[model samples]
Target: MMPSPYPLEKDLGMRYYASDSPGIGGRLRSSPEDFVVEELPLPISDPNGPYLICRLTKKNWELQQAVKEIAKHLGISHRRIAWAGTKDKNAVTTQFISIYDVTPEAVGLVRIKDILLEVVGRSQHPLSLGDLAGNRFDIVIRDCNPEELAKRVQAATEAVSAGVPNYYGLQRFGVVRPVTHIVGEEILKGNYEGAVVTYIGRTYPLETETAQRARRNFAETRDARAALADLPIQMTYERAMANHLVANPGDYAGALRVLPPKLLSLLVSAFQSYLFNCALSSRIDAGFSLTEPEVGDRLLFANGREDIVSSRNRQAALMQIRRGRCRIALFIPGSEPMASHGPMDEIMQDLMEKSGITAEDFERASRFVETKFAGTLRAISLSADVQADISGESVRLRFTLPPGHYATTVCREFMKADPYVMI
Candidate 1:
């Protein structure tokens, strides 16, 4: 059984903090150039190996798009290339990518727009997601009132040091279409047809009028031939699905199967993220301390250990937390043994009853392992150290966060505004 879908909800606003924080009221990522991220890998690069490690600095290019272009240039299959993780397209991002059976010199001849690829080294194994320790972010906020930014950032930065609730930020879901979770919901319910339609149609206010026109036409007609003409060539997945269905005719599941397995996994993971966000929001609503564990509360540590809260050990746990030894985390349910307590426990119970997803259900996973929803613990709060620099009307915020964490989480505390518009 697939996990039950969380509500196809709007932004689950700030958690473990109130909305009354003063607004920095600045805009971020006005241009792709405004945000920069550099991967700080775990010093694991090996120079003597069969794998080619390449440093990629891509400006305004999606991570996968960059990989595709690199593969075409190097004359290698994209499947053989690997990376620590993905970076957002709407930024100047840099990360190390690895390819198998390639020499360092052969990897250097690749070229793409706004992309600089250099052979960094050779590693014994291809890098996989979560292989990195963290990423360093340089973000610029524009059109700000300097005094307001200074005041807001100061307070926000101090709050960040105390700890920022580790909710998955808006980018995890589609910012414009906002239908990733919707499609995820359909998949979990075993509605592949619904998933395909939700992904292809279901236009929203945030989407461009041009895109809405094409998608709406496709949705109403279900004509792959017409859709191919209407949709731009850039909608590769949509086009591929259309081509597949044009021949297969109403084979929705097979059409969905045409997508890359990694993408299918992302759809499921998005739903998991949605549920995690909801649980965190509920905990905050109940006015529970994210850092301070109370009796009957369950805790997850950074070193991948679990603990149960008891008065005898709660204080000791708090001390360990302050010393950066442990954190509070919620489980993403899978076909594995796990448990939770306190406000998080209530949220999970509610979600479980609502979603109808049980641990055993995860055993009946999709063909791909990534879609397994194999439960894992995630931190509820992060001890982020945000460094804010105010220069006239523009502010530059710099910070480093653990892998799988979003920098926008720190900025949202200061922005106190809608992510769709401001960031």
Candidate 2:
């Protein structure tokens, strides 16, 4: 196993690379145009449906801000807008959104710079997270080592095609501060005050000097009003929490409640993602094969059916795996976790114990956040059929991943640069 060189990556439990070949060192997203994502949405249209479906294409815009602006233009509540997935602000992304009780004419009239909204169809239901079938990514890695570029790309391509650890990308945690999961850990421990403070005041060097100063002041003084005054308008969520605190005074949970429900759920889910990353890394650190299953291992099939490997079914499980029917998966624990019948379970249990979290803690978080923390299985590794093009000092990669997978995971295998380079 080849461990990553970045300390932040190690802290996130993304310790090793599946490919040991020297990476073709490069940087990703040097420009917004260099990284493009197009969602492969599932069919959700109905002729006489009440929901207006719009294909939203935006560059350098955050999804939440875009939705809020769209809501403002239509004079409607932001809650009426729904989307399949949240996209990164630094990329050129195209995805579908469902606006309830709206018309094509209204969507056409609403316009924002660098954002295009086109009426696609109507749907009987509003889009929810994971509504897409997959996503197609067109990415450029700039300023790579020119020498041995083709050879290294080939080696990495082959390795990734076989499989790479499916660790969540840096974007899952905030790229600037990476405090979402930290906030989540506090929430699961029933420390809403700690969570609110962390969300509002965690500082990172990557942040702007002004932003960092505001966060530092808040962390030191716990003066929400002052922080609100210092924080830039772009820090909408943080400002919302601060405003809530200034008014409610000591109602930390109320401060958290002011943010969008989806954002709240994502915070807790980030912690779950962190646990999965660590467990997967531990499995590799302990010399377990990512592609092989043993007695008591969980086998997850392509069709979403799951079975535990046992003395009776071990051979069948192996056969299914060889036939590309399934892969070994670890559980992402929620309020009610699925059975993980092997060392993966033991590893995750150890992590939970060390973190001082309990099942009841998740229950409390669900109630506080108003989102269900449901357990699910995730494959340990991901593979893709990649197409790479080399031209001068850069390489462009085109690939597709099923819903919920990160394109950066695939790009990191090829670039192997610092996580910040990818960011």
Best by TM-score: 2
Q: What is the C-alpha lDDT of each candidate?
A: 0.75, 0.90
Candidate 2 error regions (>4 Å): 337-340
TM-score against truth, every candidate: 0.92, 0.98
Q: For model 1, name the residue pairs that clash.
A: none
* lDDT by residue (tens digit), candidate 2, 1-423: 589999999999999899888898999888999999999989876968999999999999989889999999999999999999888889999999999998788888997999999998988999999999999999999999888999999988897788899999899998878889999999998888899889988888888999989998998898999999999998999999999989999999899889898889899999999999999999998898788786877878888998888889888887888788999988878888545478788889899889998677888899988888877889998999999999988999999999889998999899888998887
Residue 234, model 2: Cα distance from true site in angstroms: 1.6
Per-residue lDDT for 1-423 in model 1, tens only?
011122233354233343345667678889988899999977755788878787889988877767878888889888788899788888999898888898767766665779998887788898988899899999998877566566777888888888877878777776666666667767776777888887786787766787788899888888877877877788788888888888998888888877766676777777778788888777776777778786777677777788877889988988988888888778776657556556577677678679876655455544433455678778888767778888887888889998999888777776665566544
